[model samples]
Target: MIRVAVVGAGLVASHYAAGLQRLKRAEIEPYGVPLAKFKVIKDYVEEEVVSAYDVDANKVGKPLSEVVKRQLEGVVPVPPDVPDFEVREGVLASSGAGLDKMFPVRGRDQKLPLKEAVEEIAKEFKSDNVNVVLNLISTEPAEPFGDEGKLAKALERGEVSAGQAYAFAAYLAAKDSGKPVAFINLIPTPLANDPAFVKLYEDANSLVLGDDGATGATPLTADLLEHLAERNRKVRYIVQFNIGGNTDFLALTIPERNLMKEKTKSSVVEDILGYDAPHYIKPTGYVEAIGDRKFVAMDIEWITFNGLVDELIVNMRINDSPALAGLAVDLVRLAAALLEKGVKGTFYDVNAFFMKNPGPKEARNKARIKAYYDMISALRELGVIVE
Candidate 1:
């Protein structure tokens, strides 16, 4: 079994927990999960969320079903089989400010020493035999610790971000248990990209697989850029923005928090187009009424043959949280299978397809179409996928 632990019990986590249970019960088809049609080393039924953590005062100590019901009551049916484990208090570290604006914040770090809190969380992972730990917290402002010594110093000073703290806890869990763990980061913090964290996971014989999930507008924008690039279209300029009502969007209203999304979202332009296209791509606003379905608008102008200027405009309303939740379903199983195959450290092929900024610090973004085939090919060669 691929036992999993969730780091945040927010909207996305609610969707993931509820949707996963429904998938297991065969109550709904796995329509949104990308690799559901393919045969993978780990079956979807083998995946289970054994534990979850959160820093919100309202969420901590509450059952996941209760949290899912509170967030998804009328929106979607809360799965009756969703895990009943209490959501433990997670680390706050440098992430408290933005989260504090949304709800009452209380992290284990606030009550115990930061390291002790991490150890406590790690103990749970070891006890639960968690093979995959998903970081689905709201975006927070953070910089990479390029060196292991620097990371250790930051942890000692309690200056690490919440993602970093939880990553360390997973590392500790792997080290103590002598079992491999996959820390799948679905947030913007730099675990997969940071050499320090990558090396740390390598030492623990574990894996770290992200920087940011490529869920909504960013992946679509990437493929459009690729289409333009392949057709030899000289892109004049591109503009893309999203506005939503989720707590994540509200968190982005903070300048620093928003900048984190900008870095991950904007990287696709330069990486895929082979030149930095003049573009504005990021979350622009938060409207409470818009809820989890976000509004996306994109405009691109390009120079065609005969000095002609052509323009393309696209608009969409995307279910933001459930989209990532679907991706999480695949990632959890993939992470466990990769670990079982003795693939430690970070894997770029998987990250390239799933993450906005695929990691190991040097990887670049690729169009989702090409990335999808390339990742499938790689996984096949590794015996992680069949047929």
Candidate 2:
């Protein structure tokens, strides 16, 4: 069984936890509940509530048991046999990763030193046999700008970040554990892109990949549009506008960070269309207190030589985290399989199908999914298993 440690225990983190639990047969342990279910306090009442943590006075020092009760608020409770995990304090300075207005405000607690945090994570891995770390934190638009080496050294030296020490601190800690670590980023952050970070993982003989997990309508829309374009269909322009009250949406409200997300999302579509398809992809708005739902509106324009133009408009709303959280569960198992088989950085197929921003763009639609299956099959033929 691959013991995977989830970095953040927020709303999305909860979904990731649930998704993993759903895959229990596949060996994914719950880090907590899914963010959506967390809101449905009544639903978790009888469900198994694993580990949960946040920096909030209301919840800061609360025990795992209390946290579970508080989370239940008005929801139904499950059987008493359902176990609960501890709610640690100062795991983060702020849920600023995205927990601003959507979820309850986190309390201000003394932050953990980066060194101590790393040591805690490393110790957990060493003792628990955690093989990979999945970052289901908020959508941190700001990516690492080539400073993972500094971050890695800080972990070794016990350096901690209270007010935004480099974001890759968690990645470095996982690497330092000396256990083969495979990191899957579901948010649009750049930890996996920096050369230094990549090298650190490579040097450690571990694996790291993913800048974003392409969940929900984004991937569904992108792949579908690509299908039309590949068929020699004329794609004049594409515009995708999205809005949600989820933490991911709440996090991108920062103007600077929003721009980064816009550019990254736009580029994914741009790259898929090859320079031929003009397009705009942006997170249009943030609706607070709606819990965890994402609404997407997409418009596609195509022209035919007959001098006529055709347009396609589509709307989709997804339960933000669950749509992609399911994939994250698969990724942990996939990562373990790769490590057990001695695969190196960026396993292409899993990254392509499961990530928003893969290392490279390949053919869209069935071809892309097919390619991924082939890659995993090849690896399996090599007899890789999670050690």
Candidate 3:
């Protein structure tokens, strides 16, 4: 079985728990899950959320089932069979300032030293036999630790971001247990992109996939840019923005946190188009009344034949958290299967399609359509995708 652990108990985590249970019960079709149709080495039914962690005081001690009901109350039906494991206290480190603005914060590090808290969490992972750990926390301001020595120094000074702390915990879990674990970072911390963490995971025979989950306007904009690129269209400028009511969007109201997201979102232009286009792309605001469904607006102007200018304006309303939750479902299964195939470190084939910034610090974002086919081909060659 592919045992899983979630690092955040937010809306995305709630949707993942509820939707996964429903999918396992066959109460719902796997509509949003991208890889549901293909037969992978690991099946969806074999995946179980065995543990969860969060730094929010209100969520730390509550059962995941109750948390799901509270977050998704009228939005989605919470399966009665959702796991009842308590959401354990997670690490906070330097990332808690913005989170404190949203909710009362409490973390294991507050009660103990950062290293000890990481060790405590790692013990839980070992005890729970977790094969995949999902970092679904809020966007935190973090810089890549290019060297393992620098990462170790930062951990010593408790200067690492929460995502980095948890990733280290997962690494420790794998090292101590002699069983590989996969840490899929869905938030905007730089674990997968950081060479230090990638090398650390490799040493433990574990895997790290992420930087940021691309589940909305970012991917769509990428494909559109590719469409223009393939046609040799010269792009003048691009403007895209999202406004949402989710806690994540609220968290993005903090300039540093919002900047973290912008860095990931804006990378698509230069990476996919092969030239840095003038673009303004990022989450702009949080309107509580709008709830989790986010408003996305995009305006692109490109030079057409004979230097004629063409413009495309598109607007969409997307369910933010649930979109990432769908991708999480595929990621959890893929992570476990990849580990079984002895794939350690960050896998670019998987990240290019699912993550906004991909990984390894140098990996360029690809158009989702091209990324999808390329990833499928890579997986099939690895025997991870049998169908």
What is the Cα-based lDDT of residue 67 in candidate 2?
50
Put down candidate 2 lDDT per residue, 1-387, tens digits, no spaces: 555555455555555554444444334434422222112112221223233335544655555445544443343232233235565544443225445454555532235554565455445545555566666555544535355557556545544332222234334455566667666665666555556566666666677767677766667666766677676567888888888886567667877668767655665565565554777788878887655677888898887567579888898777776666556655666666677677765565556666666642232322344445565565446654211
Q: Please provide TM-scores, in order, for all candidate models, with all chains considered together.
A: 0.99, 0.75, 0.99
Candidate 1 overall Cα lDDT vs. reference? Answer: 0.92
Query: Global lDDT for candidate 2?
Result: 0.56
State which candidate, 2 or 3, has the greater TM-score.
3
Query: For residues 317-383, what per-residue lDDT tens digits would candidate 3 score against the true structure?
Result: 9998989999999999999989989999999999999999999888889999999999999999999
True lDDT of residue 56, candidate 3 = 89
TM-score of 2: 0.75
How well does candidate 2 score on lDDT at residue 287? 88
Query: Each candidate: what lDDT?
Result: 0.92, 0.56, 0.93
Give the Cα error of residue 293 in candidate 1, in Å. 0.8
